[model samples]
Target: MARRLFVENGFHATGIAAIAKESGVAVQQLYRDFPAKEDIIAAIVEADCERIADQNTLNTAVANKDRAGIIGWLTTTPCHKDESGDRMFLEIAAEGARNDRIRSIFQGIRDQADENISRAFAGLMDSDMVEDEHRTLAQAFMIVSFGSIFLRTLNQEPVTPASEKLITCLIESATP
Candidate 1:
């Protein structure tokens, strides 16, 4: 309920009353559970991050030795397929800018994702190499991956082909 409202109306534009009404919970109960809208947003973001980590399937891919497949999945699979999902993503990102708590959550999500990407790529290549190198590549991979969605959401040309090519190249470069 709150998720729908947040996706439709945005973070700042959404109100506690609306969330309560949409969720079919009493305002007091909602407040007791989540003292503030930011708390709700925090809970949602944390859950979403965990979901992304799971959906990436990076660990499984690495375990299976599917090196090339990881790049394709990471750049595309985690991205939202529809515009509304993209909008909610962008909105949450913007909200994170002014809200310190939200920003920290975003940072944690990014850091955790970077670590996972680095590990996935490292395992895929069967290499025990520089953490710094893998970390840098992971950062770039994330930028290109998320940047594609932002570009598409803004009605710009999709960046998937290029991001895919870049990620593939990075993977190959790191390959032994």
Candidate 2:
């Protein structure tokens, strides 16, 4: 409930009273669970990560050793459809730019993503592919994924198919 409120209202807009009221819990109980808005945001981010990590797509990608399949899975996943989740992720990302702890957490997530991509690609490509090339593709993939989310959130344009095409080209480029 606190996560929803924080995502909908942002860090500054959400209040403990509102969280307590919405959650049907005492304000003190809410405080006991989370001392600050940042804590709640962190918990939300953690939950989102866990959800993504536990997705069947990740399992399929690992088992099939398919780069394109992994990209397709990532593009089609509805994980980011939650408006509150999107808003909260953006807010924390922005805050990460200035906060060491937030930055560290964000960096950890990025690292894990990169590692996963590398593992996914290892079976699709030969040893001739360089680590830098793999990392570059992973970063590009992340950019496209996040850009699609933002564009969708704004109702500007749908970038998912375009991003899939871009990722396909990237995979080809990394091939031997």
User: Top lDDT: which candidate number?
Assistant: 1
Ten-residue stretch with the least lDDT total in model 2: 121-130
Question: Model 1: per-residue lDDT, tens digit, 96-170?
Answer: 889898788778778887878888767756764437777887888788767876888887556566766876676
Pull out the clashing pairs in model 2. none
Task: List ranges where model 2 is wrong by over 4 Å.
Answer: 55-60, 63-81, 126-130
Which candidate number has the best TM-score?
A: 1
For residues 1-176, write the lDDT of model 2, one tens digit per residue.
Answer: 87777667766678888988998999998889989766766677788877765546765765766666765554454234666566666777777898777777777777777766655555356542437767776678678767766766677455667767876776676565
Per-residue lDDT value at 46 in model 2 = 80
Candidate 1 stretches greater than 4 Å from native: 63-75, 78-82, 128-130
Clashing pairs for predicted structure model 1, backbone only: none
Worst 10 residues of 1 by lDDT: 72-81
Per-candidate RMSD, Å: 2.5, 3.2
